[model samples]
Target: MSRERRKHVVYITKNSEYHCRDRECVAVRDRRSGEWLREHSALRGRLIGAVTAQGRLLRRMRIVVGMRLCLEGAGDEQLVMTSVVRNVGRPKKSATCAYAYQSWAGVIGA
Candidate 1:
């Protein structure tokens, strides 16, 4: 038996800086793509804290919410702009995988 993967589509904001120290620096992500879209912060800092603390669980974090992401998969694709994280809750007790989406994933790796 095999398990299915998950995927999500998001429009990442352009030319933005994410700061954790100053709340005033906070701002909702804006979609700069030609596609009309609503902005959402997909990943949160709480999740980062958990990942940082659990070094034994993952050797390195290739992805983090709020990070500027570019697709590295096979074939030439333009930089897929999207927000890394929307929100993060308290850590779960039984998380095994290094990458995860808490609430929803639109596709299983499209």
Candidate 2:
């Protein structure tokens, strides 16, 4: 029998960890069998939008590490930011910031 995929609502905590209502966040393990079930995946540069409580799209937004989001379909086919009324906290610096600085340094032969 094939198992069906279910949608999930997740949020990033202040420490930059993914939390879910279903207790299926990344790096979670089953108490019975100590097997790794999930791992981090690349989601950079993906287009996401804020959603209202009534499932309405508010506006397009970027996926930050501290935002609450809902995955609507399998393989993250649709990612919608949820709970716009709650405070998501400030986003951290982009990972590319260091890379951009290094690139500029190389160009200047510094």
Candidate 3:
């Protein structure tokens, strides 16, 4: 028996973390649609847009102290927010890498 080869692509970005909603973003896609929806039941009456995971692959990315991410929401409003990842686990075979920058510094180490 032979195994299929997996295709790999590298994504370049200065930051890794994205300020998207928990349920309304590409983080959770319903099985039925096979499409990412920009809706969240957790946030009632509040509207937000979906962040596509398709284009969000960042490899070997490091997060700085003051990195900002444009979070998309309802009315197409973009909220500039900063964040930091306190801890990261070892990358799995299916896991991807990410980069980030902040006021402190930038990291090339994923």
Model 1: number of backbone collisions: 10
Q: Give the TM-score of candidate 2.
A: 0.29
Query: Each model's TM-score?
Result: 0.21, 0.29, 0.21
Q: lDDT per prediction?
A: 0.28, 0.34, 0.27
Against the true structure, whose TM-score is highest? Answer: 2
User: For model 3, what is the error of residue 41's alpha carbon versus the real structure, in angstroms, after optimal superposition?
Assistant: 12
Displacement of residue 14 (Cα, Å) in model 1 is 1.8
Supply candidate 3's per-residue lDDT for 21: 21
Which regions of candidate 3 fall more than 4 Å away from where they truly are?
1-25, 28-66, 80-82, 87-110
Top candidate (lDDT): 2
* lDDT string, candidate 2, 1-110, tens digits: 66424323334333233333232222222224533223333122132444444555534453343334544423655453333323332222342243234435553112
Candidate 1 stretches greater than 4 Å from native: 1-6, 9-11, 15-33, 36-62, 73-110
Clashing pairs in 3: 15-99, 15-100, 58-97, 61-98, 61-99, 62-99, 62-100, 64-102, 66-102, 66-103
